[model samples]
Target: MEDQTPTRKNNSYCKRKIVTVLTATLTDVAQQTRAAAQDLAGLSTDLKNQALESIAQALEAATPKILEANAKDCQRAQESGLATALYARLKLDATKLAGAIAGVRSVASLTDPVGSIQLHRELDTGLELKRVSCPLGVLGVIFEARPDAVMQISALAIKSGNGVLLKGGQEAIHSCQALVEAIQTGLAASTVAPEAVALLTSREETLELLNLDQYVNLIIPRGSNSFVRFVQENTRIPVLGHAEGICHLYIDQQANIAQSVDVAVDSKIQYPAACNALETLLVHKDIASDYLPKAVKALQNQGVELRGDAAVRDVIEMDSATDTDWATEYSDLVLSIKVVDGLEDAIAHINTYGSGHTDAIMTTDDQAAATFCSRVDAAGVFHNCSTRFADGFRYGFGAEVGISTQRMPPRGPVGLEGLVTYKYLLQGQGHIVATYAGEDAQSFTHRDL
Candidate 1:
């Protein structure tokens, strides 16, 4: 019994050890990532691409190891009764792995955002001013079940000249470790510092990381609404990702029947677990009787459980959609349907109930489509296209940090450009501001050269 106590204590110590180590490691890595950012900032585009290429290759070589870890996570999630949507998100088989690897290579092929000069102007004889792009150092990314996120985010961090601290959900711990191992191996062959990219394992470590505003420059959280809101409230660091993905698709009266059905089915069924997948669908009253039954039947055949508003309930046989249903982000094989008076009413319902994430309208009527696209206050407003098109890779941004529903400049897909900010550089031969201040001061030339 006495001997067994020490063994039990040792096991307990191992379990709790990483939490303390993670705190210290995060503090240490923050500085290291900043230093790595400086080193990465000056490196050539080709070198960065080379690093990404190495990471992709290393990942491809380590597929079996990664899959084995993922399997363990999946098994545990099943036993723990994880939700169906998250379970789907957590699973990473060969196809998703290949896509993640391919995404890395795609990032490698993107135009380098760092060191790009946005503006160059000669102020006056030899006095020059330039605004150039630079990395946001030490990003802390906290995401949910998708282990593929680890690969995409790390690759983006490397390509964008940013150091990232990744915190994935507890369910995907083993998979995250396996992915990080391959990533670090690739980083070893690159110019980035050894500690530039890191992952924190324990749940306690994440709370500590939120307080690291001094070290972590930006925090991007991708998870449930509560999870994202908690991160935002706890962290002084800037949060840049959207939590609610209550996207909407409206079919105008003039919509092509085949086109509308195809986009609707694909949006909800092709990959319903995606953040940009359709959630609420609004059809014009003029077209509801004609379109609703067909839409409901097709969706039902795909195993989608439909919930509809009162008007929709009259048109299709389905569950009654409550107030809660309208506000929900299913992220599953489920959708809420409604019938609207017209394009404007559809737009109003979307703006009121939607998350400002992604909204689309399917209409052959050019005027109605134009009105809906312009009036709807969402990050992405598409015409005659599926809401699922609102993605970084699909939008040709390579691997993104995430979709930002922020109303600011980085309002949509957060690609490499979103990872960088601008710095104003002034070049002068001892030119003082006094010369440009008062009477008899030199007139400034703001001409672009």
Candidate 2:
């Protein structure tokens, strides 16, 4: 009890001082990564691929260390009463680590997007114009739970000729550190600077990182709806990610019951922790009597807890769903079911409550499938398939930065193509823009080159 007032003040002062130091260190790292990104953007495809291969090998070599670190994280998360869904995402076993390593190797085999000419033309004689793809500089990625995201994002960043600063959830700190250390160690053996890829361990760094608009070109946040929205609202940097993933699957009257049941079961239970997993199941009223009982049995057998509307409840026994249930992104084993009058009603329900991430229609009717594909305003619209198919790797992109739901170019699972921007290049023999000026300007040729 002696001098307790002064001790509290001293503790507050220490906290502020530590935060200040961390902020300063983060700024220095951003500057260094910006500089390193410039060097990376100029490297040839072969060189970049070599670097990725090295990283993959390094990750493979460090598998034991990575697994041990992940075990510690899992233990801590378990002891702290972390959500089961999040714990699933946080766990990185040998199989998952091997898959991540394989993904890195796959990224190395992709066609490098840098320097590809999108447009080539001649404005006039000896004046050639070309629009070429280039790197988008440094990316600041903030993700939760998924430590495997560290490896995927780093490989994608390096392959796309961009630098990245990764901020993983505190739950996966040890795993992230182990992964990034191996990545940097691999980069040390390659031409790419290890600084091009870094990990920021503290939550304080995430807030400070958003303020680094000067160095970070984009901020990709992958987490809960509220967390993603917070990142979007706080950052001046352009955000590229979806806030929620309230994906839906509609069963039409013309749907093959066996196929629809399989798709629905797979979508909900295959990997419930994934963002693309089905959350809301809409059934055509005409098919509800025929399909609901079987689908409910299949889903329940797999441990899916369903909350259904009145119409769905009449067919099968389950909990009642509220209006809020329609809009929820239950990245877990929970699902909500509704029975719609027809295709129009199904589409309306989806458009109203869906997160615009991924939605699918299970039907053999070609016309209905085509209509659903065109009318649904989602990043991914599938016919007779599971929403989980809406993935970057499954789309043959090797890996993804994250899924973007904004009504913009980089919507859906963002791959290397989404990471690059284009620049215009004009070549001339001492030519000036004044030559194309008004009045006596020479008639110019706009021929394709």
Taking the candidates one at a time, how many backbone clashes does each contain? 0, 0
- In angstroms, the error of model 2 at 221 is 0.6
Candidate 2 backbone collisions, by pair: none
Clashes (candidate 2): 0
Tens digits of lDDT, candidate 1, 1-449: 00100111111111211112343454565676677777887788999899998888989989999999999999999998888888998999999999999999999999999998999999988899999999888889888888998988988888888888888888888999888888877777776665678777666667777878888889998877777777777768999967788999999999998889989998899889888999999999998999998898899999999999899988777899988988999989999999999988998899899998999999988999889988999999999888888988989998788888879868888889999998999999999889888888999888998
The numbered model that scores best in TM-score is: 2
Q: Model 2 lDDT vs. the true structure?
A: 0.89
Model 2 Cα displacement at 57 (Å)?
Answer: 1.0
| Candidate 2 deviant stretches above 4 angstroms | 1-24
lDDT of 1: 0.84
Ten consecutive residues with minimal summed lDDT in candidate 2?
Answer: 1-10
